[model samples]
Target: MDRTTDTTALPLIPRAALFGNPRRAGAQISPDGGTIAFLAPRNGVMNLFVAPRGRIDAARPLTDERRRGIPGYAWAHDGRHLLVVKDNDGDENFHLHAVDRETGAMRDLTPHGPIQASIVKLSPRHPGEAVVSHNARDPQWPDLYRIEIATGRSTMIAENPGLAGFDVDEDFALRLAARLEGDGSQTVLRPDGAGGWAPFMRFAPEDAMTSGVLGLFTADGRATLMLSSAGRDTAALFRLDLETGEATMLAEDARADIGEIIVRLHENTPLAYGVNYERNRYVALDPAIQPDLDALDAAGIGDWGIQSRSEDDRFWIVGAASDTAPGVAWLYDRKTRALEKLYDTRPDLADAPLAPMRPVVIAARDGLSLVSYLTLPADGGSAPRPLVLLVHGGPWARDSFGFNPYHQWLANRGYAVLSVNFRASTGFGKAFLNAGDREWGRAMDDDLLDAVDWAIGQGIADPSRIAIMGGSYGGYATLAAMTRNPERYACGVDIVGPSNLETLLATIPPYWEAGRSIFTRALGDPATPEGAALLRERSPVHQAARLARPLLISQGANDPRVKQAESDQMVAALKAKGIAVTYVLFPDEGHGFARPENSIAFNAITEHFLAAHLGGRAEALAAEEIGRSTAQLLEGAEILP
Candidate 1:
């Protein structure tokens, strides 16, 4: 077995190049500022990678081959153990585990079958311990449980029937518990030492005007920041004084949806939080007062965030990215504003002189504004090229002008891709997001059509060779577009998208029990006859018989949100009608591909599918570029002529 094999003989990588996949998350900073940990897929899957603190430190893998969705882990107070959580069953039941920093000791904290738990906080005083939240007692709601690191013993700390979440402060204390009421209202209950509960803030159903009740980001002693989705107002961040019960508006935009910060490096201090508004924008927590944010901002130099920040907060890290540079590691200097390149995530893509992402604002047929990102072939835009209408998931999620892999892939293949931030998208005002409510298969799908027309109007897209692709909500839209309005898209690709809105709303996982509140507001009540009918009318499945174009569907076998049955039903119905459809399922993945092999494999399959139909280019598949699963898909697929 020669360690040196011919990588060139294969499709993607050099034999000498590192195999397996790199991590998907950014590197993390240790509380002591002496080390950093990041996600890296070493043996064909993603895991944690740690490195010593300094200008130069060789990174080492901290976590071995493990299950996915463990991004919700943190370091204990002593920073000697990494507390991790994994969802064993398909229902998203999480089990907590402890990993020792010095000896890489991996131990399960919760051993119950299909028991669901979450790591709420790491005790600052008790080195290798953490405060966990689980619904072990109640399947409907969760409470706090203190877990001992060495032993798998858990003690009941606080139990509240209405508790939805718990947060511990820097002192390892369970300071706040967010309880959800039946009426979609919320209450913040503070922990009283006497084991009593104190109400700090209460949000009523009518107070939907100020959803400041969405829970607050309570730092050790800093004021809490609430992310509110007030009516007709876009979601924004608000600062509430925990002492005075007073709230101050920190950031708001009637035209933008604001996001909040849940995690920060070192003492979990609030540093720079990110908000994807009208475009991609990051707001630091007054970097002037705290040099850490500024230093972290400059960590790798440029505007990139480093894997993590230091404890003392002298030097900060920023991750760097560009059109040509998918993700490059850099160290930025706060004092001198100097940027130093550390490593490039995808060095093999150096020759990809990709074009920058540009913003475009077009009026919906109804005169409403829609924001979109326009990516064209690098050959100086003006020419009309084939177009790919890339719909994004979370129709609630906005697409800013940035480097998106899918967008680049489509553009690189000589097709202009248009990703529209339709009305339901956040970052805009509440009205914009609300405009998308209940419009799923109707106007929302219209917005996508309108975007294609805009590309035609801009003379950038060849209307004849148009295609549409997306996952989840986007996948739903892809099917809806082909079903609701048949002649618009030449080809449709749905990835883990719901075929029926009613089924999706009803079959939601237990962990997403609270999502019903927001879903009801956005999608109406699915239990009611009227809501059921409307959802059916808007469902792609209900209109599957109307399909006239080729379709490609991909789904995760264990996806809790978008059930595999969604894809199964759609495919069955389509094939039942004698329609040609391609389907792929990854048993090891969840909602999205957590492993790089999955991504590269899916990308290769998608490219081949698109090229043969759209008459575009398909980059030669490579072994190291992905895994055997990816190559298998391309083996028999018809390549572009």
Candidate 2:
């Protein structure tokens, strides 16, 4: 358990610079390529802004969103407006809005109260119209509606018949639908030509998440694109013949699923596809775009993605970033083979001593190959520094090699940061994902322990000064690690994580009823006695008495998936045992902290807590920092510096 290190100093990166809103991000080109739009901070809140193409200096804000910033936006096909989606304080009841570029007027396209609405399809054929989905009729199922973007008039095109989701063509025609069965399997259905739906394909429960219809790819409505892992180890891209029921394989990887597909705008024709293992490997499906991909690869600026393209595909807004650098947006001219840098997402980090993330494969005790990323302090000599195990949420999601802010911030604070893609993480093959079924606190926790052993064995971490931190499932993992093996970690941070599986299952949002079976099957069903007992046994709340290290818990008041009760129950149990656990709550937040101020405030408390226990350097919390956020310290304020 060596803790000695050569303390070659590195500048402490400010929490604001690392966690604050980006200078400019989500850049996209207008349909005619006459203007560029991106999300930038307007009065400390991210708002939609647009500028004439190549004239970022002339940018003007189109929307004045003061509270929770706009999450994402896209240019309308008509080129007259921009489409944006917003939710209230991370409640996730998203509402679609259209911003008129000329008048600077924002109109809520779907103003239904407390309903989750999203744009389903926007077509150039119907330039002023968009197909949207909302659960106004029934909270459990969202119905489809065609809406006039300018006037916000709507017409119900199709009603949900207990379908999970629907797919539409560029012509604004609903062609395919997917239904999640009670057994956790998925069935793809097609229109029967007489107002009824006929089953097109069926997938087992294991392939439910990996397999689905992507979109109708054929102009004749006879074929569609799909990603399916049935009869294969990994999910692969395929063109499915709707009439013949045959699938033509397009691209695939043995190690990873097809994660991204680049297609021609409005045409549904795929140009390239990408699969991610340790890093992303993009393959050009159409040879015409090979040169563009080649040029981007040759640029040596990390992984690049085509963010937006002109109508004629002559101009592309490309975003590139790596593990050590913040993202840079570039305007790529396809005709001239030139890449002009637009702006850095975070100019403050351009000169920061950010650590490089190295992807490593660790063997679980059961011999499962766990893909993990490690980032050590830039100038802290290789003498086994204190380590932080940062787990990703989703337990269904994964930790890929990228410019992760948490990694940089923690590394700058003088701790080695490691993120592990343990069992149940997506993007890997189905066998690896299905292997984690109902293994929440048992096998899943073991994989983390094995990763710790590997880090310590490699002289990368001091065995005694390790901490676990994460949100959602990662938060659950942090709590599980602290309680199951209290001797391993020095401290733990849990953000919006569920403590009791039974309560978590019972409190899921009504809109998530479609996928409830998937959760029950993957994490044990609470309705059955045997399953309920298993859930109770695996829940960290049941093992709270075993906790022996410092713990920090943060929660959003309105988390629909993992409700606030989960955190409240765990804190109550710990307090009942006279254990001192720090609790921070954001009344405005839901699943996680969406506001940068709230994030910074929580991290401010977290760093001090870690510093006290793990001997890591921390930036002292400023009074103004917490004043700007809605974070309420409900407990353990004494731990703050």
Top-lDDT candidate index = 2
Full-model lDDT, candidate 2: 0.90
Candidate number achieving the greatest TM-score relative to the actual structure? 2
The residue-by-residue lDDT of candidate 1 on 1-641, one tens digit each, is 22111212223322112222533446556677566666655665567667775543487766775444345567666787777887642446678888877777788888766667887665445666677877777766677787888787888877855666776665555667766665556777887668877888776543432355433345456666676664446666677667786767666655655655534433344444566654555676655535555554445333444454445544445566755456766554445656555566666566645667787888899998887888876656465777888888987676766557777667766678888988787667656766876788888988888888988887887766788999889899899998887887778788889998888988887766754676766666777788777888888887888998878888888888899889888888887888778887777666867555666677767777787767777667665554554223312234322
User: Candidate 1: lDDT of 475?
Assistant: 94
- Runs of candidate 1 exceeding 4 Å displacement: 1-20, 23-25, 55-57, 66-73, 87-91, 123-127, 172-175, 179-210, 213-223, 229-232, 257-275, 282-302, 331-340, 620-627, 630-641
| lDDT tens readout by residue for model 2, 1-641 | 33333444788899999999999999999989999999999999999899998898899999898898888998888999899988888888889999999877998888889999988887778988999999999999999999998899999989998889888888888788999998889999988999878998899998988888887567667787889999998999998988899999999999999988988665667789999989887899999879988988998878988899888889999999999989999999999989988999999998989999999999999888999999998994878889999999998899988999999999988899999989889999998898889999889889999999999999999888999999999999999889999899999999999999989999899899988989988899888899999999989998999999999999999888899999999999999998999999999999998899999999999988898888888887899888999989999989877
| lDDT agreement with native, every candidate | 0.68, 0.90
The deviation in Å at residue 201 for candidate 1 is 4.3
* Residue pairs with clashing backbones, model 2: none
**Candidate 2 ranges beyond 4 A from true positions:** 1-8
Q: What is the lDDT of residue 559 in candidate 1?
A: 86
> lDDT, candidate 2, residue 568?
98
